[model samples]
Target chain A: MVENTTHSEPSGDDIRPPKASIGVIGWLRANLFDGWLNSVLTLVTLFVLWKTIPPFFRWAFVDSLWFTDGAVCRDAPGACWSAVTTNLRFIIFGFFPYELQWRPLLAMLILFFLLFYSRDRTHWNKYLAYGWVIGLFLMGLFMKGGLFGLTPVDSTQWGGLPLTLLLSVFGLTAAYPLGVILALGRQSSMPAVKYLCIIYIELIRGVPLISLLFMGSIIFPLFLPEGITINSILRAQVAIILFTAAYIAEVVRGGLQGMSQGQYEAADSLGLNYVLTMRLVILPQALKIVIPPTVSILISAFKDTSLVVIIALFDLLKTSQTVLSNPEWMGFSREVYLFVAILYFLGCFSMSNYSRRLERELDRGY
Target chain B: MTIADAEKVPFYLNPKVRAVFFQIGVLCMVGLLAWYLVSNTLTNLERQNIASGFGFIQKEAAFEIGESLISYGSADTYGRALFVGVLNTLKVSLIGIIATVILGTIVGVARLSSNWLVSRLSKIYIEVMQDVPVLLQLFFWYAIFYESLPSPRQALNPVAGVFLCNRGVAVAIPEAHPAHAYILSTLVIAIVAVFFLRRWAKTRQEQTGKYFPVFRVGLGLILGLPTLAWVAFGSPTAMDVPVLQGFNFTGGMTLSPEFIALLLGLVLYTAAFVAEVVRAGIQSVSKGQQEAAMAIGLRPNLVLNLVILPQALRVIIPPLTSQMLNLTKNSSLAVAIGYPDFVSVANTTMNQTGQSIEGVALIMLVYLMFSLSTSAFMNWYNKRARLVER
Candidate 1:
């Protein structure tokens, strides 16, 4: 009976999908050429890519000048990537003493280590927080060295990538707690506190960061006592902190508003005070819910740190501009700016990707 | 357990008492800080001999604005220069918002296209645009305009009467005439009429179970009224084509490179965020809604308009309002790119007069006014879009 069945009936392997409905051709047909309109769109897009990509590839790679001097680059028919390669040190560490470049570089490595180590959800604990605190301390010591047998560098001399990182990371770290407090104050039942928090948030958020930086650079000194001057970097950092805190407060407020009444009532029924309720019950859940958005705020704040260039702070963008203004690097603004943009893009992209992953990981619990 | 017992509770321990005391304490601390800052500011201003008041706004600006909507020169007052800056800011922001909405909507829709290539391309565009800083993009565009584009003498004239050069885009436009104002007024009147007509049409459709071609009629009125007004006032058809004069073009509109770069960067960068918002809004409307509408014999276009869009827009408008506000705020980055926006003009004023306090205050006031007005409008719109519950 088995031999008869095998000879007369077709097996599962033989009864496969039709040739037109499976494999690469089917994929192409289904995805790109499903209908007349889609087919036309596919053709048009292909044509556009065909026209643009080859020329761009030639300009950016094939004929590009990588290590040449400005004179050769001027006559070259392609991009002068040497503008970035030659000024790499200045672009990364700004005016920090030439020999002491390793300090910022080392500090950056430590920052990256801390960041990478904390990326996994399993590693998230109080120890990770402690790691950040210690790592930040080391970074500070390295950047401003007086006790480690290293040359003391002025904060004004701190510029470029490290400065961008410092402003965004430290600013966000400091801002988060203040933002939480502000959010709590806004959500409080006390009218006076709520109004005060609301007004502060609204006022800070109404104006752009440029105006705040302007205030820091131009108007902040007037608010200080005579003979006491804050450095420009510190002023900018403070402005960033205040600006970012306002946005963070708004985001956290959304988280707070999203909590169900039942959660609060349950906490109350458990005889918990407001602080305990928020800390142990409400905030833990609310903060988790808002993690994705808070990361977005952080990403934007990181990008906004580049605005310090407007006030003449030698952040990465400003350093790139300085390089472009050089006689040797003249007319190579595109290469330098492109390089700086890629740096910023990488930082932002990785953070956004992490946020998305975290969102998915958190969603798994539901 | 009695009210008397509650009143007898320790004042420090009573929640209400603690709340009042906390508030009072906050107020006192805030008042003291404000007082200290003001005193310091006054002392510093006196020491620096920098006059701090709005009176400086009336002084001659003595600085040339690259471009201005109104008639402005270096001889203009600081107030007038600032007004020009305000106008420029409004011009860029309004134009940027419109362009961003259009481009963002298109990209957002493209991201969901049935064609995989189209969707992937749009996704890449969004990711790249969103990741890059807007200021950097502005700088990049500015550099391209200045360093890549040819000189005015060798401008790329893709079409007759249009010039693309390092200087800016010079385009031909219809010469201004008095009749244009009358036609513009009629256009506004037609728009108002269309609004009421739409309401009436909706009401009629609900009560009498009949549809009115409100859209077609509105379009006809909007276009026909403006045309009739133009004809009645003697159709002025004079064209003011840009012509090369000396090193630059004159006699027609010339959009400065700074404005172009700033507008392009702001629109491109903000459109990425708006695209995400739009995608989320569209996705929020469930597939069942579309299926149900189709089952009820509604046309595809009608299903999209009557069922999907109304639902989706409710999800769209709140975040979209924030995106608009963000675009407006980011336009302040024009200061970096040499666009004589409000912040740029204010910076110049601050530097010239050393009245930093007044300049900062004015900047804050103007921006706050913008934010408040926008939020107010959006709040009203959100109220209208909200679902009506029984």
Candidate 2:
């Protein structure tokens, strides 16, 4: 049974290390190049790189169909940059009114800048306050435009990236507080409210968000008074808001439930009310526990903005679809879809990576 | 002293009084909001002349699902259509869950392999799969796997002339004979017997460190007994291999592109999540546990079986349960791929009948039931597999 078996666990102060290398490099040599399976996989991956990477580089850069205007794409023999150029506005705007496109574009840029600037350590908390006040004021001034001698853009005209960003930011900002309250309410000792929150959370969490969105699309109108009608964008936002709140509640509730009851007792002993206890002690821990899931939910919501297309709201994917329907570039479906996929991938991938890092950071204690 | 203790809570500091005041305020705000919304809905519905209620569920559907498990067509009632949708959703979830678990476990174990390539490949799979939006993955797989398939005339017969094409795949299937029913019955009986026997063996093992060869026995009982009956039943089912027909193949079994795409996407997307769960589960078992088993003179395999795996399963099963729930929920993406899952069918029913309220309610109820059952099943499993904490 022991005939010439050479495998053994290397010792800790492995004197000469079984040759020139036995740790990382030896392990790699023994694993990757040792067998046909590994070799084949290696070859396959290399082959894939060779095949896809070159063309990717070429089309994206080297021989790219860039900057020759919309008409030059036909002769370019690579990815049609012309399609992106011509359709870029629609792709980002969805259906926002053409006249006030600058407002949304500005707002989106400001939000992006705010997110980046907020992450900078040099600027204290006051910067965010300034950004918020000025940013919102400017956005409102631009969007409403009645007092600025700017052409007023209707909400219906909001189409692409701006709409998607606004919806997501609004949904997230609204959902977080609502979600926390609901999570707290669900975990509360109250007989009526706890049951109510539980029912709401479970019912919402059980279904696909698309179903909720569909319900909202259909249900929002039903909830409106006879004479007054809400805009479709607002209707969509309501669906997203409720759905986001429910999901965020679950995430927050996870954090809440994970907290040892000792923390609550300790807070209670300190004579702190529920609000003060939560704000000071409970929320910080729960927020840490649920950070990764919260980010993922945000990412998911970002991705989910595409689903609004199903309800006839022209988010990015819808904008892409609109591009495809163009009579001039009718058959260029692949290019358009790829562009949309790339944009989505960028957002989703970054958040997923960030979540992984956050999870690691959070899990250090565990 | 009790009276003094009761009076410790000042009027301003009375907790019950505070709760009441806060709740009343909350209730007032909620009531006003609800009142506004309800009045608005009433006006809207009345103005639109839209009659609400679920009477529309009984109306004839006059529509068809591309893929139907149960007997269904355009002639079916709306209720029947909804049932078909529910069945489709169940089918996708069940199949997707099973496939994802197997694939995920395989990939997860591979990631721990001494083989660097295997681990790297698994990592790549997880990243690529998780990075792309599921809808995009669905479309990608649908386009690549199904839409790009050769025409029926050029069908690729990978196994026994099973032709795969844009329409679907056609394969050989057995035609059931009369005696086949007895064979199936015998199989069921054998499986039940095996289950009971396994439970008995487990108890016996626990009672006296003498382990029964339950795996071998159960396998033999389940497979052997049914196979014996199959011969005795005179081979009722006949093999029916798909034949090349005019533009398409005449089938034994068929899988539409929509079903294929939905299953592929669900499996691919979910397997990444499951791999992470499996990895975490394995990692959760501390090295000391394995080393302790080894120090006690057990072999590596025995160490894993006796100590590491048992403890790991405790950690694994909980999150694994949620992954299953996620897989089940993700099956709703079937609608996007045009595979008439429950949601899609419900949507169609809603649209045709204009009974949005009823349709939405039913969708929620069905999903609730699905999620509830899944959670219940997980709880039961968790209890059964619970660590024997002293």
Candidate 3:
């Protein structure tokens, strides 16, 4: 039908569109007020916005008690942001000795700086790898502190932003290589290897991260020799790695399947060995094609780090809960939770936007 | 030159030989690690004097579960308590999946609305929901439901015979009698008969090129059959209207605050992902296809139902299945709010019996089964959807 329309030669009347349907007003008419149903939808949406937005604005900002005491906040008819400011320290660095709190703060800054540095794909090199290693080592040193004449803090003391970053950053980095291996194993000609990979991926993907963390914190201890303790934080980290790797493996396998078989045949015809063929011909394209899904997996892995709270490790979310649990600041949970929500939103939203942009840029050649 | 060209490569350099050797090496290493762990666990259990295995599941569970679908007491065995927990988990997850899909599909269609405000609102919702961590959302809703509601004595009666309080939302439900069994069985039989009727109708339509009112007929079979059975059985179910008696409401179905909050959190969070899936699925049906359908004089609704939806569903079902699986697994987060879900109950059992291994294993097994069943159903749907081609 469209072919028939296109095949017919256009006359003068067909070439010139109607004048009332060409500008911004015309767009509004066509899209928003195109018909009776659309007009009603527009009015209903406007009514909903009018009913909700103004009150939210007034409560969140106009009447909000941002810099005040608990008593003052209680008297106020709006949000009590004082809950956030008053307990900011506890929320950001839960249970780290009060005087040495600067260490975690420093560690978090380093992580953010490293993350900012790595966002530029043009700077991808061995230097970036070295920088991450150095930065992560520094962060660990600052948190754990067995060297540089600093007093040692136990792993139990590690909490808040540093723990969240450590879990997500390390978890994703470790998971990616492991995921690639598993993806390869799943595609291998060796039946045992293929089945092993398939089973591992499926089993891990089957359960929730909470169950995995529970296994790490409670059940894994049973497997260890008596009195040989692994810290709860590390165990949870391992669980996150295992869980995330399974998902990432599937995403990577999708990329692998997308590659043309001709590329493999060409490499084989060139007398390239299996390792050389995969490393030179397959992996680079496969990994590039998978960047968007990989980033999504990373983003969700970052969010799943919050589940460590179930194991009683005080990551950012748990710390916020602790802040609310204080009787004096109990009624201001709305302010505290929203504040934490913003932090997560910033991380997730930015990664997703990056993925979209990267997808667009990669699509250019196609 | 011929001698050098004909020379054979060493066995160590052969790729196939190396691959087999690597596999054997890995297997042995894994086997050794497993052996070491098992041995360590056996000795550790011996030292702690905590005998291991599934024997403890039969022991009496002294801990109280806050909510249950079946009649449960502290006197029940650990196995029964866990079963109650499983039922609770399934209850919330089933409700969450259904609610999320409906909400997601609406928002997804709204995102494509010609009304600019509707699409923008939907976009904002998806962005906010996609970004926030779900556990935090759960906590946010839980906090609101737990603290912000009025006390039981002054509970908000938003509608007739319904009460909402910090405790929970209570509404009227039907009280079942002995004759309800007969009614239920009759309804089930009617539903099976309707399923066959629809199949026969479709086959007839295909063979004869005649339209049948299959949907309306099926609906009548479902509703009329159930109503007739109820009447025939002397109205076996009676309304159990809730009444404010003393400090709290009595009678009717009570949705616990924990269950409601968890339901809202899981549904809202998973809906965001499902919305994106739906949007993608709908958008995947090309504009050309819609235009072609319209050119054939098909109405807009018919174009959607007959042409667009079948194609959109092909794209939608795979991701939809994953989202469903995710919602089910995420019901475990009910533990954070003391929802007494499978994970929470198993955790309690583990703490009481010191059988952490078995408890964790059971949780994993249950989740695996849920995942497998969902995937199995999806696979069947995929096959059916594919059959629509040609």
Off by over 4 Å in 3: A1-24, B1-14, B175-186, B229-238, B296-302, B387-390
Cα deviation in Å at residue A205, candidate 2? 1.0
Model 1, CA-based lDDT:
0.94
Tens digits of per-residue lDDT for model 1, A1-366: 998887885655567788887899999999999989999999999999999999999999998999978888888999889999988999999999999999999999999999898889899999888888999999999999997598899998999999999999999999999999999999988888899999999999999999999999988999999999999999999999999999999999999999999999999999999889999999999999999999999999999999999999999999999999999998888889889888988999999999999999999987
Q: Residue by residue across B316-350, what tens digits does model 1's lDDT show?
A: 99999889999999999999989999999999998
> Can you write out model 2's per-residue Cα lDDT over A1-366, one digit (the tens) per residue?
464466664668666756535887786678776678777777776788789889887877676665555556666767776677777877887666655577778887788777667543356477677777787677666655677587767777777777777778778877888999899999887655786788888888888777777877887778765556788888888888888999899899889889998999999999998889999999988897888899889987887776787788877776776776777665455566677777777777877877887688668867
Error of 1 at A42 (Å): 0.9
Candidate 3 accuracy as TM-score: 0.93
| Candidate 2 local Cα displacement, residue A147, angstroms | 4.9
TM-score preference between candidates 2 and 3, better one: 3
Number of backbone collisions per candidate: 0, 20, 0
Winner by DockQ between candidate 2 and candidate 1: 1
| Alpha-carbon TM-score of each model against the true structure | 0.97, 0.87, 0.93
Query: Model 3, range A1-366, lDDT digits (tens) per residue?
Result: 999999988675566567679888788888788899999988888898899999999999999988788878877989998898888888889889999999999998998888888888888899999998999899989999989898899989888877898899999989999999999999998776888899999999999899999989987888888889898888999999999999999999999999999999999999998789889999999999999999999899999999998989999999999888878888777889999999999999999998998899789857
